[model samples]
Target: MSEQRTVPETETETDTETPEVVAPEVVAPEAADAAAAGLPAPPGGSGRSRRVLAAVARWTAAVLVFGGVGAGTAAGITAMERTEVPGLATESDGRWEYPRLSLPALPQGSPRPFTDGNEGEIHHADLRALLLPAPAGAAVDPKANGGWTTRDAFLSAYGKEDRPPLARALDDSTLRHIAVRAWTMPDGTRSSVHLLRFGSVGYAEEFKDALIASEGGGVVPDILPEGAAGAKMETYGDDIDVPDTRPYIYQEPKPYGPEQIRWAYIQAGDTLAVVRQSRKGEAAHVPFQQTVTLQNQLLG
Candidate 1:
């Protein structure tokens, strides 16, 4: 608990009607008796004195009841010296005036009210409902008359006769699954996500086109023959510098990740991904040739 400081200490002296002691001449005891019996004050004191004292006591009691008059007659401050914060020469309006603080009021129609930064972080979601970020810049979908079912139709959209080897695709029912697989950086600061699409050739081509478009690149048919896993690993690895990563766990907390990468590679299936790196993390590659061997599985 905080301790309270005492208000300024003041020394006050006062004249309390000191009764005058009179030398009573040798008067008859009978006369003094008659005066005392007839009045509240005896012969030596006047009845007025008793009445005045009583009045003073009542007045003092009333003023002190709440708070006494400050630094004045009623204050009972009879002193030889000074006081703190100068006595008011004029009647105090009795209202305490505080310093005026200048600040800017908020905009008229602005939605959110005044809030601390930490409080703002909490309420940001609600405020964002009124003001949202621009929509994601996604690629415009290509024009197609109806659902594409044939290998040639969808393949044509990616590219016609001039399409890279990526244009050709083979469907596989051996392991049909759509999954999200990710590769993490060594320091665990980043992850590259792939939506692994493993199925027939038609679907795989579409997925592949989408993936390449996202990467802002087209497949290289001349360098790596069509549908060849080993050729792709070498070609893509060289193009992408796959040699520069540390050891990365294919799966997180192990619910079937490493094997999935193997399956994705061997199935000739396509994986759609957007790569993001952790600003703060760690990777490596290869039994050199053996590492190339593993990455080649995707070419299947």
Candidate 2:
């Protein structure tokens, strides 16, 4: 074998460079803390924070809903206890005395307050019960009969002209209430009555002046129609001898001598009573008698 190798002179091959193996480097605790402080939170932690914020928002909404419900309940209770007027009832002579009023009978139905009944057919809050010891019939003229709460309605009912001036003259604010009734009698006689309440006697007097001016061209000396035969107006006040009284009466003669139309106004305390009657072609004392009867009732 030694003699064969020396003769052939064969060579062995070897690498000049080789790669080195290295393990992965571990992260330092200080580097991890620095990243947490300067950078945004991880996805998992961000999701958990969102869940907590949603829970707080839901809790706040529930609190507001309960608070609103409580406030509404209290307001509803207060509204139910309100009264129309203060000190509206009183006692006298071992009996309760209260404001009581009535309306005259009509051809079809009785006159009732615009505000009436517990549920009130008209203005519910404006309604009040009249503590009357007994029911009384309203004083009325058979010719004109109806009821309304406002002057506009009154003018419309009678088909009067020049409504604006008259409406202003009879201002609704000046009167507490008004009731009207009218009808044509079986014998062709026409009549009407108005029951008005004023804040005071002085106010009633002022209203009376305006009323006459509106209906009969100005209150002074009375205006007469062009062809009137001889219109006469008779007023009776202290002359009647009733206790604490001032009354107004006027008789307007028609163009024809036989026809008679009369108007009367009376005051009892804060109330003003009025009547208008037209006798077609005859004379009767019924209108005056009716006036006297009403005057007596008011005084009583």
Candidate 3:
């Protein structure tokens, strides 16, 4: 397992209301006796003081009762599991259970990629530490186990015929590092994430533009993933709102063979990430989207 830096999960605060306290009617003994005897009670006597004291006692008791109920409700909510709470429980949505994620520490005196004063927008952290971790129960690929990889290893995902030109482009693009992580889930879904860091944001954007060109009324990558004859741009049903990142998602068109492939190219600062997921029959949309969005977030 690769060493990771993790941040605390955000805490959610729940608001609980105290039930209203309604004081019961309190009558002085002298007043009740006088009313029963059809005679008025003496004014300005001890009855007024007794009534005031009795009312104060009743109010105090009501306050204590309601306060205890509110405290108990809060405690019960805190003790219960998140899934046990009504309206707060999240049902299974086919999303993978990934490990907690946090940005890696940068070298002392180095600014973050997207922070002010870093005009080039270069990532100062270790590339391997930035790679997304494999989801729970995934079988990780040793060759691409969240570590540095050769350019050829990254190019191997594309068809052989396109490798030569892509290699030349990478050389000219000032590619700095390539960090990859690949895994397969129990459901037979294979996922690979590649982060290619360039010398600057300009070079990264240029290489990304060169890799993807317009084709047949849509944009498609010049070098398609291995086993994918053709792919088309796909718009995600849900919006991915990572800051300072742009994702170009593509899906293998219909009439695919035994398996289907879905991939995305995320351009963020000096890093361009390739996230791919394939499965027999059909590639699940939820997991692919989830993977791409998360990778983009990490890069951002």
**Which runs of model 2 end up more than 4 angstroms from their true locations?**
1-149, 153-163, 212-231, 235-241, 257-259
The CA lDDT at 169 in model 1 is 31
Model 1: how far is 49 from its true place, Å? 99
Candidates 1 and 2 compared by TM-score, better number: 2
lDDT of 1 by residue, 143-180 (tens): 31111233443233232344435333324222233222
lDDT of 2 by residue, 141-199 (tens): 33333453455544453223445544665674266777665655445555555566666
lDDT, candidate 3, 255-286, per-residue tens? 99999999888888999999999999999987
Q: Determine which window of 10 residues in candidate 1 has minimal summed lDDT.
A: 126-135
Task: List the RMSD of every prediction in angstroms.
Answer: 27.1, 37.0, 8.6
Q: Of the pair 1 and 3, which is ahead by TM-score? A: 3
Q: In model 1, which regions exceed 4 Å deviation? A: 1-176, 181-186, 192-195, 213-295
State TM-scores per candidate. Answer: 0.20, 0.41, 0.71
Q: Candidate 2 at residue 186, lDDT?
A: 48
Query: Against the true structure, candidate 2 has what lDDT?
Result: 0.45
Instruction: Give lDDT for model 1.
Output: 0.29
After TM-score superposition, what is the CA distance of residue 84 in candidate 3 from its true location, in Å?
Answer: 0.7
